[model samples]
Structure formats: structure tokens, C-alpha cells
Target: MPSSAGPSIDTITEGGRVTQVGEGQEAEESVPPVMTFGAPTAGEILAERYELVEHINNDSAGRLVWRGVDVVLRRPVAVVLRYPGGDSATEMLQAAVAASRVIHPNLVGVYDAIDEAERAYVVREWVDGQSLREMVADGPLDPGRATAIGNAAASALAAVHATGMVHGNMHPGTVMISQEGRVVLADARTDGADSRENDVRAVGGILYFALTGHWPHAEAPLRGATAGHGRAAIPDGVRDASGAIAAPRQVRAGVPAYLDDLTMDLLDAGIAPPPSDVLAAELGRLDIPIEEEPYPEPAGPLRFAAETGDEPSPLASVGGRKVAIGIAGLLAVALVGLLIGISALGGDDDPLQTEPVARPSSSAPASGAAPAAATRKLSVSDVRIIDPDSKLRDELGGAERVTDGDQDKGWDTDTYTQPNFGNRKSGMGVWIDLGEEHTVKSVQVSLSATGASAQLFAGKTDPPSTSAGDKLLFTSYRTNPVGQPFEEHDGTTMTFNGFDADAKYRFLLFWLTALPSNDRGYQVGVLEITVQGS
Candidate 1:
């Protein structure tokens, strides 16, 4: 029998097997949940080995974090409520194993998992600081700090997704700022979202909140790099088609447009790249670039390029003061050529009607020859100027492909999907409730090169076989431009034939070569994905 201190009497029970005691029955002490939030105000202390310190914020599923103790250890330890829906001992182990693989500095590290009498308990490093939400409650951050935080957060997401896992619950509140001002994800959740895209959208939400100080602009665009209603399902702050923001200029003048654009990509790239790391890198190139043109001779008389005062070329410079010099001669030649073009243009009476009818200057050399090599413009698809892969992966909650197998194309939550891939990660996922399976001769595919960079392979195999990998149907993608960046939001599809769609392969394959720096990849919402029958 256990003794009680006051009104709260704690008790202990076993698996029953109690023996009969002769005439000695007494009231037992009642046991609390064995945990309390923050400090224990006036609750019953069943065991005096530990004390409650402070409470952390609430979780998405209403779970809470408390600063608690091992009276034995006397050290600060973060204690989280048991995660529900894990069903049994096995699920608890799976969730724990998946989380343990991630090793990143920016990510909150899990110390241990405790399964106490059917309830799961998680203990993590105690971060003695406020959350980003609390800090931003007053107002948005200055540009520099905001950009730094964004860069760091993006890095955390990148590390997580690279392991082939999702943070399931990444948001502002989930980000904790250490006493030293380092931001770490509160918890790397895996218990939510059937697909990885949910995490992507949530990442956008975090950066928006971080920069704007509020969630008023929470809706960042989804993964495509285009502008239209076909891909218009993005949240508010994102502009149409392009994964661009609502132009930071609107939020505050002198705001870096490059930062705004990158913020949009990072927010939109979920699990592909954390926006924080991306922002940090973009901040380096964040200055307003000074564009220059080839030296334009001043537009005054032909002597402007040479004169200091209202003077002439060195032609006006004579021997020392007005001699014909380099700039002066070049100016004179351009002036004469301008006179000829002006004459050919019929003299501005008709600006649009000026026809280029001259084949001339053959005696003056060919002017139509292409100038020396032009500077190559970096597109959205190939801009590796600020590659944040290494930095982003530093936080480490990346996704990992656990199961890879080939089977008949039927909906099997238990059946794993894997394809013959090359130089990258490849697989297809969908939420399918296939009723009566029918023959599938053709399949529709939406291969996203924006969020998750990948190649799509479509082939028909006799008996619908993926075995021996001999059945080669059709492959689409630039072998050379595999993960190169492009300047547009677009996608492509491939078709295969010469085999039986009878194997029920209405669904196709997704070969993820590289995730967008934002952690973009293949994902399907409840209604967005479907497996059809022929």
C-alpha cells in the first residue's frame, strides 16, 4: 500500500492476480497521469524522483511538451505526451526508428522514446528559448535577420527530405529559437499526412509567418513554375503560374525582389529545400544587380566622348588639344552610319513602317555577324549559382525509401512500388481504392520537374512484367539536362505500348532524381490522385 500526502490519493494496480487478505482492506492512493505541465502547481506527486519545470507549446494534435525531470538525474529534459494512432508496440518502434536516422544541427534531436504501460513518451533536448512565433508576435524581422532565419530553416527541411522522409508537421510554432539564437525544428513529425506534399505547403507557411510577422499571407504557391488556373491551386502570397511571391515591394519598399522570389520557391519547395537556407544563400546575391550596357558614346556632337568642357574631340584638340583620337574617330564613324540608317528609315514620319531595304556596307564590312559569345542567362531550372543542398541537408529529417518492389498495378497499401530507375530515386505513390481491377492499356502521368526533379519511364511489358528489366518501352527527359533549372513551370509525360494494360497498370511511375531545394516531390492529395481502369 502507498501513502498519500493530501486529498489526491495515488494508487497502483497490477494485472489483477491479487491474493485474499483476511479483514485488512484499506483505501489506496490514486495515481495521476505521472506528468504535469510546466511546474507542478499543487498536484499529487506519486514519485518524488522528478519535478515539473515549465510547459512547452501545444502540438498540432493537442499534445503538450513539459519541462520535467528525473529527480535522480536532476537535469532538464523535454518531455512530450504520447503520440496517438500508433496502435501498438510495432508502430511506436517504426516511428522511433524513422526519426532516429535524421542527424542535423538545425533539427530538434530526439533523445529517447519511452513506452510506459501502453503510453508513449518522448524526451528531447531542452531548448531554453522562445519560439519564432513568440518572438515575431510584436512585428516582422529586419530584412537581414529574416533572411538568415529563412536560410537556416530551409536547410533543416532539406536535410529531412533528403532521407526520403517528411516532417509532416513543419510550421513556425514548430521552430524553436535557442538561447544562442539558433533555430531548430521543434519536432520532426511523421504521424500525419499520407503524402509528403503536406509538409511542403506547411514550410511555406512557416517562412511567410517568419517574414510577415503574421499568417495573413500564409498561402504560398504550390510547386509549378508557371502562371495560370490549371496550376492555380496555390495559396495567396504566391503569384500565378510562377512560384513567385506577391512581390515584397508591396509589403515594404526597398525589399529585395530576389529574396521575395526565393522565399516563394523555398516556401513552395517543401521537403525539397527549406526556405531558410535558400534565403540565406539568395541573400548573398540579394543586392539589386547593376546592369550595364556596352559603352554608349555620349549623345552630344561627335566630340562628347572626348571633351571635358563644351569641347570637341581631340580633332578639336588639334595636335595636343584637338587631335583626332580613339573615341573621337569611333564617334565620327558611328555618326556617319546613323545618318545612313536615318535616311533608310524614311525619316521618322513612319516609325513602324521603316523597312530594312539596305544590303549595304559590304564595302564597310559585314555588320550582321553575331557579336562575340553572349553571356548565358541562367534559367529557373539550372541556376546552381547558390546551391544549398549541402547546407540544407545539415538539419537532416529527409525522407528515406524503405520499401522498393515491383508488383501488378493494383492498389495495395501493403504492396510497395519501385521501378527500374537510373542515377536517382524512383517510385510512384497514390491513394487508390481500386474496386474490381480491369485491364490498363494506357496511363496518364503528370511528371513534375519543378518540385521534385525526376525522369519518367513508360513501357509495356508482356504479362506486364517489371522483372529482368528487359521490357523497354519509352523514356522521356533530357539526359544531359536531368536536374538542370529552367525558367518556366511545366511538366511532360511518356507513353508505353506493346504489353497488356491487363495487369492493371492505370497508374505510372515517378523517378525522383533530385527534390527541388524546397523539398518538392511526388505527392497526391485525397482527391488529386486517381488510379483508372481500362
Candidate 2:
């Protein structure tokens, strides 16, 4: 006899057995076909430890995902159950075992795999987030956000590729973003059905989807993604009547050319996909930080060999600086020569200047070069907060506060529960637009508190509404206790230097990567920004 509080038992007269009854009972009882499969009901415990609480959704691969509880541990879990399963059970278990062997922050952890003869299920960590497919259901994503998502996926796939294993299945359906702003790849099906190139290419597909709201790769096995009228078709690229898939820029207005090229290159079957590690490295390089590095003093200018054997050359003892300056000079001369040739072609041929003009002296700076160690402070405009959540955005003054040359008045970030901005969003940043591009030498920042860390990033394009990693300049960053000057640490001043003098900087961003301390809660004030450039 079962108590009223407990689950009711139902007798299957045909099998002469008593079965537990719950949500799926009616469906199971109505089925009189030869292959009678019993559906798992709510509160039914499988393997004695997992209790199914609610059905989430069925995957395209024919797996039922249920929100369940580990009866033994009392922890929530996701249980993927497959019914009327035999060979599929074997494959699922194998995948579970394979996935379990490789542990990565981006991968969903497998807890257990078991079969009950009639059905099979694989228990895994429950992610508190939405899938990539769900994210773009409303519309396309920002290119920078899309690129960041792809970078994370590529990094995770690189780890799997390192072990000679493949994710086998890579699609928007498998990408997940937690509530804390962490991106992770999930539901890996490693059956060798897909090649490593396919995985890499899928990353491009993700980018395209994020940029265009449509999957570019027709062959990607994603639900709600098809090739016909509005969706991308299989195998062939996302195409129109012209039989060519439009580049991201063609689909959207603000997608950067570099990003468009990278996405197209990945989707183009004509081009071989780069190795996963190489792709990861490329993305890593493009991710620019906005924080400044302590700028060291400039090295000496170039020197040359002395005409007389006994006399020391003016450029002697020029070690590393020599090579850098030499390269710069050579490049300048080549550019000048090319320009002169073009000009000569367009003008009347003058025999007096038939030959190329003499190149600048090895010791002399190029005609266009700024005075040695010339520095200028730039005034930044259009400062803004980078919070992604519109409702949660903090109110701050326009770009003028930090540039007003007033330490007493600065911009403060919204207080967060955790040092890392509570992981609810990527860390906030203060972005500034230089009126025009310049050859930057270094940047100095003044902050209200210590221990906050930031990296500097420069790009011609407007900084995206979010803090994008692909636009970072150098990974080298600056950090310290704010307002607390120590023996060598100037508590109020954070200096960033060693910028590549050859590269030009127009728009600058100072993005915080970590908060100094949560003792006072997570917030930092941008007091001032002093840029050194020409």
C-alpha cells in the first residue's frame, strides 16, 4: 500500500508489473504500438539518485533534457534522456566518457551515465544560462560580442583538439552564456563525424550569425537554422539568388572590415582553415585592452658606422634601438621612392630627375618624422560607460569629467557585489576618442583608488558599446593601489608607456580588468587621462 503523500503506483496489467505514475503516464498508456516506450515522468528517480523535476527541451540529436535533482547530493543537474535506445545508448555513454576525460572551464562537466535497459540518460552539470541560439532569437548580435563569443569557443575547441579529440558538434545550439557573463561551449558530441576544420569553420558561422542573425554555413546542424528563404542552407554558404553569401559588412552596417574578412575566410571552403591554436592566437592578438602600461623612457635614436676607422660612429653602440629605427627609416625611404615614381609617371619626363632621388642619410630621421621624443597631450572626447544591460547602466557625466584636469571630480563605476564586477557583465571601461590619429608614445591615468588594473586599446573604429577584446593594442597593462603612493608606487598616478611608436592611435580605451578590493565594494574613479603622442 502506498501512502497518499507518496507517488501513486499504477499496474500495467499486460506486463503484470506496478509502475510509478506522473506527468508522462497518459502518453505512455495511450501508446499501443509494437515499440511501446515509457516516457519519464516528473519525480521519477532513475538510477536511484537522479529525480526528474521538469522537462526542458528535446535536442535536435533526439535527447530529452530534463531539469533534475541528484537525490544523493541534493544538487540540481541536467539529465539528457533517450528512450527506446540501444546503439544510441552506447554512443551517448561513449561520448559521456570521452567528455569526462577532458575537463575545461568552457565544457559542461559530466556527472554520470547509466542505462536502464529500456532507456538511457547522461547526467551533467546544470548551466544557469541561455544557449547561443536563444540569444540571437530576437535579432543579430554586435560584431565585437560575436567575435568574443567565437574566441572563447575556439579556445575551448583548441584544448579538445590538443588531445586529438573533436567536438564533433559545434553550433549555436551548443554555445552557452551564463548569467555571470561567462561564455562556455556545451553538449560536445565527439564521434569523429566532423573534422577540426569543420569546427574552426563553425566558429565563423557563429560570427556570421551574430553579425547577421543568420547562420552562414548551411551544413551546420542547428535547429531553427535552415538554408531556404530567410535562413542559411546546408553545405553551401549563406547565399542569395546570385549564389554568393554576403559578407557580414554587406548584411550589417557597422561590422568592421577586418572582422568581415576573418569571418569570410573561415567560411570559404576555398581557403584552408588555420589550426585551432593559430586561430586562437590570432583572435587573442586582435583583442585590444584599454588600460595603459607604464611608459619607459624612449631609447636613443639610430646611429651609423664612422667613415674613418679610428672615429666612433655617431650611431655606434645602438643595440636593439638601432634595428627598430633602421627598419623604420628603410620603410620611409621605400615609401618616398614609390611616391616619387608615381609622381614622375604623371608629370612630364624630366631628364634632370630621371633617377630616383637620394634616400635620406642612414643617420637622419625621415623628412616626415616628428622631432625626436616629441610628445603632445591629447584631449579625449565622448567618454561613456560600457555597461551592456540597459536597465542596469550607471549614470555618468559625458567624456568631459576625466579630461577637465580636475582630480576632485572624476567618473566612478557602479558599485558591484564582487571584485570582478560580480561577473554580471564584462568589466566596465572608460572610452575616449582622440580628435584625430597620432603616433602615441605613452598614457598616464589618475584614479581614485588603488589595486584596479586596466589595459590600453586603440583603433580607428568607434569603440563598440561593449568592451571588446579583439580591439586591444598590447596585452601589457598597468595596475596599482589608487591614492596610496608607496616607495616606488605613486598611489594617485598610473603611468602606461612603451607604445609602438610606429603605429598610429586615434580612439583610445581604458578598460578595467580587475577591481582593487571589495572591502569598500567594487568601484573605481577615472580622475584624469594624460596622453603622450605626436
| Top candidate (lDDT) | 2
List residue ranges in candidate 1 displaced over 4 A.
1-64, 70-74, 83-93, 191-204, 216-245, 265-534
- Candidate 2 structure quality by residue, lDDT tens digits, 1-534: 100010011111112321111111112222232223787789999887889998764433334557789999998866666665456356555545555555456555557767666776666666566556557776777655776788777777776677676664455645667666556665343545446766777777777777787766543233222332112221233466745577777676776545665666566553335566656655553443213332121221111111112322222222211111110111010011100000000001110011111111122335796435423355565666544433435444554787776767878776777767777655556667777777665566777776676665555555345324322321221231111111212244554544554666766667676666546677778887766555
Q: Model 1, range 254-307, lDDT digits (tens) per residue?
A: 434334433443332211221222223333223222233321111111100111
Q: lDDT of each model, Cα atoms only?
A: 0.32, 0.50
Global lDDT for candidate 1? Answer: 0.32
Error of 1 at 171 (Å): 2.3
**Candidate 2 runs further than 4 Å off:** 1-38, 60-63, 84-88, 219-241, 288-534
**Cα-based TM-score, every candidate:** 0.38, 0.45
Q: What are the clash counts of all predictions, listed in order?
A: 67, 36
